[model samples]
Target: MSETGKDEKKTKKKGKGLLVKAIVGLGLVGSGGGAAFGMMQAGIIGGEHEKEDNEPKLVRKGEEDPYAPASKDKETEGLGEVHGEGGSEYRTSYYSFTEDFTSNLAHSDALIQVSLAASTRRDGRVLLWTKKHELAIRSAILGVLADTPEEDVYALAGKERLQKRLTVAINKVLTEREGFGGIDNVYFKSFIIQ
Candidate 1:
């Protein structure tokens, strides 16, 4: 073969080899992309399924139905009250307080009433019931009241903050005084700011 013809032949072969390699590389990339897309479509990737068997099962034990309403004999007793034999129940005395405090900023009179229900443990130790915690809760309420403006108390956000503050304060007093007794909650059963 002539030198020029030979050179031309070699160049054509090299071009064909490069084209074949590029086609193979493109095919591999396309296949990988297709597999990833297929996995996503089939929900095998980045998807979650909640199985019915994985859910919590409610089991009925004893004579009580877990799903059914409480029977008359199995009625729940209120806090500080205990059920006795023969279907009788007893409640300990509860402590509570009501006070009127004047706001320094708004110069308004605020009436706050707190109720607590307390109980004694089996060890014969006197425990502050929710009713009794009212006194200690009063101190905490006064603390927050002393800092809150009268207008703010009327606002929705302010009321929420006040409730949270009262909960914290009551819990703090219960922790400090009785060691572990907690106030069920502080409710503004009646609130009036004049």
Candidate 2:
């Protein structure tokens, strides 16, 4: 190895290293520009997308429901003035309990099962509240049914009274959980004694 040969080899190695660094630097600049372009397209940074309609359409105060049926104010449609004081025009809605209630009667070993449904002449919010608090409501209904006498399951009048009791129990639950109780009545879809 001569001195000139060693110097020439070192110079060539330095040139190769500088070329690789320059290529890497150019690659880094290109990728950075691409990232910036993407950010602008996605409206994350300032660009021509400045006036993009990305704001949310939140429900403001006093805004009416978009899907509700249009009708006259203060007057319920399809429900005009009644002739007598006995009857009033009102639409009734029913919500059936998802599961049948089965429990042992208080005084006897007999088991009673009742599939119940609640009626409401109010708005659909009552139904939504019923569904939301169903677990609590079912617990209350089962509590009443468990204490029911075995004899009450037989007589028509006794059953009627039981229905009234059940209605009161459910209304109590609704009133406790929600501010209002809109339940009109609770009827037994299927009542069984065993």
Clashing pairs for model 1 are: 95-131, 95-132, 116-130, 116-131, 117-129, 117-130, 117-131, 118-129, 118-130
The alpha-carbon RMSD values of the candidates against the true structure, listed in the order shown, are 13.9, 13.2
- Candidate 2 lDDT by residue in tens digits, 88-157: 3555556777789999988899999888888766655565567678888888888888888888889999
Which candidate tops TM-score?
Answer: 2
Error of 1 at 122 (Å): 14
Question: Model 1, 2-96: lDDT tens per residue?
Answer: 99999999999999999999999889989987897788777677555333332112222222222222332312222222323442122222223
- Mark the regions of model 2 whose C-alpha exceeds 4 Å error after superposition: 1-88
Candidate 2 lDDT trough over 10 residues, lowest sum = 75-84
The runs of at least 3 residues in candidate 1 whose Cα sits more than 4 Å from the true structure, single-residue gaps closed, are: 1-135
Query: What pairs collide in candidate 2?
Result: none
Per-model CA lDDT versus the true structure: 0.50, 0.72
As a TM-score, model 2 comes out at 0.55
Question: TM-score of predicted model 1?
Answer: 0.38
Error of 2 at 115 (Å): 0.8
Local lDDT at 26 for model 1: 89
